[model samples]
Target: MTEPPRTVQSYIDQTPAWPDGTPTDFIPMTAMQWRIWLLAPAGKFFEGLVVFMTGVALPLIVKDFGLSPAEKGIVSAAPLAGIMVGALALGGLADIYGRHRMFVIEMVVFALFLTGLTWSPTYLWLVVYLFGVGLALGCDYPTAHLVISESIASKDRGKLVLSAFAFQAIGALVRTVVGFLILANLPRSGRGAGYMPPRSCRPSCWSWAGSRSATAGIG
Candidate 1:
């Protein structure tokens, strides 16, 4: 027969309980606990999805608007600028107001900026929109990191952080594929318009449809 395990209360009672506790390095979790850990960072799903969509649509925006490379760089940099500001500003506020509240605020701001992006008329307007997006992204990055870290057990921290970060890579790949698809479909009505004979490339067809809808303004 297997021996029964001693209760922790009994064990603690027997030991020397230091008034100023000696901090230990080790933490432990069971196999089942470890398995449950796999789901703890699922909040990243929403964050990852948003990031993937933004990255995917960026190239399409450049193509549709016929922006110069400098403009593309500037537009792309706007979000980055927002990120820097958001990290410095929102990060501290998030720490003060709590993670959940900041998360909600961040997501709302992201949605607003994304909607704005769809309607942006001028390059400057798009850049301004992207600036907000960057700020939201900055707020989310640390907030999500901290949330996943604090929620998971010490033993599972490594796995949780790694899993959350790994989602970034997945998001990037998804964005890349979507970008290629969008570009492939959009009308190639640029300087090279006559070079490639248009035989209804997939992206071009979608772009044509999109243009017609834009002209019609069908909500």
Candidate 2:
């Protein structure tokens, strides 16, 4: 007697051919694609550098401006206050607009204002510059976080975010180097004496050999 016919489902279950021979397509990523991922952090590194310098130079800045310590505190507070307001305002905009576009705009605005800080002629001008810095600071933090979540793969998201933070470290390093260089070269006075030295000795050696010397005056 003939065996009963095998059903389609039975054939499917029995067949290893289709499973083994299935065709699929996945485009391999290029080196350029990988590099593109780093561009964001590179942008962030510059931002970090600016923020770092501002902090490192604060004491010297207070002296330069002849500000009372309390006034110095207020000047320092300005950026934080601006950042908070910026976060409230720009964060909302970033959420409403696309993060990428908003981030670009924020970065350009920040860079411009940060340059202004270098040339600000008065305390008011400096505060004005920092207001823009606050706005940029607010937008960048959330925007970078959002970009990492959206751009990287699920397993890699944590690493990308860490990479962005790593740039902050890099920025801090850059600012430290810059502050030291400036102090080594610039003139300053303290403790009832002027401290100006030749530009030959390194920061470590100079600090020890001291005459107050250009003590971290970048602000």
Candidate 3:
């Protein structure tokens, strides 16, 4: 016998305690679903994190390094250009190589590039790192959604995919606030007004030069 469809009132009457929410309501997620949900958004989070952070940091980086217009343009475009290249050239490889392997590989590459970005010794290296970071993020963009969409219920796919993508906005907003706070409070000792590469990675020679420059400027 065919099942009867529910009335509008029946749908409205539902609540979470009604023996676990139905698909139309707060749909119950499986353990695998939960993991994919949490993990998928991470790609967008990093996309927003690095993209906004780089854009924000660019001014300070330029001021500190005294970049010309052409050099500045290249630095500005490197990551974005990488995103396009990666999506076109590398994203499709997930089909042949398998999504799981591609996902892990991309994230590993992202981490390495992110670490290198912090330790960038010169303009060329900085651009290279940024491009790599973007490339990794680009590769993850399609794979993450595919993983989530393929693994979840058809009813829940739209909600999960949208929520996962929203992380980019959240990441952008959070990083913007963080960048503002750091800029507002950082001690202005020479190059301190500019971006400070993390202490562990800061080059001693450059650090000394920045310090010396700051002292001279202060005087």
Candidate 4:
């Protein structure tokens, strides 16, 4: 069905006003604005990093946890469930509480949970940490745009937001390269050589083969 005509919110229609009472459209970026522009996309960047890094690490995770197929499925879906819950619950929290406030809170939560994930001692703990991380990321995912557009000059909004969004891709790319390097270079069990020879490498192969030895994991 076709939608009704759209209208911008009256508040949204009003341009941003900086603290120094500068006009919104044509001014240079302030230090705070630059900070926002640089940091806002961290949500996307971490989202991509977590998703791709999880896939890359799944084999080791499964092996370490002795997870069966069903359990593996649960492991894979836990973060997603947290994202769903965060989107439903935290989104409104931002609206009710405050966007910028929640944006900062979410990252603090994200960092806490991410650090917790590294030291997770059991499968259940791992799932919990992942869920927490997902929750923070989910809340911030939408907040990033609100924080950016409201803080930035209108002339630079499109360019800054798009570049910020690309952090997701950059994060994924960085993880893929890191994963591949570790796989092809590190010892399997402190015994023999690495998983695959460097000559056999391909940058594009990580999506499927990422969980195992980078080269071995690929088709």
- Tens digits of per-residue lDDT, candidate 1, 85-159, equal 887777776688997787667767776675665567677877887687677777777787776665556555676
Error of 4 at 138 (Å): 0.2
What's the TM-score of every candidate structure?
A: 0.62, 0.68, 0.74, 0.71
Q: Give the candidate number with the greatest TM-score.
A: 3
Instruction: Give one digit per residue, the lDDT tens place, for model 3 in 134-171.
Output: 89888888889888877776667788898897998987
Worst 10 residues of 1 by lDDT: 210-219
Each candidate structure's count of clashing pairs:
6, 1, 0, 1
**Would you list the rank order by lDDT, best first?**
3, 4, 2, 1
The C-alpha stretches of model 3 lying farther than 4 A from their native spots are 1-27, 189-219
**Clash pairs detected, candidate 4:** 209-217
The TM-score that candidate 3 achieves is 0.74
Give the CA lDDT, 0 to 100, for residue 71 in model 4: 80
Residue 10 displacement in candidate 2 (angstroms): 32
Q: Can you write out model 2's per-residue Cα lDDT over 50-146, one digit (the tens) per residue?
A: 5656676675556455677777777677766767787777776867888778877877776677656665657777677767776677667677677
> Per-residue lDDT for 18 in model 4?
82
lDDT by residue (96-189, candidate 4, tens digit) is 7788789878888887777667666688887898888789878887788887887876667788877887988987897798777666653344
For candidate 1, the per-residue lDDT at 52 reads 48
Off by over 4 Å in 4: 1-27, 189-219
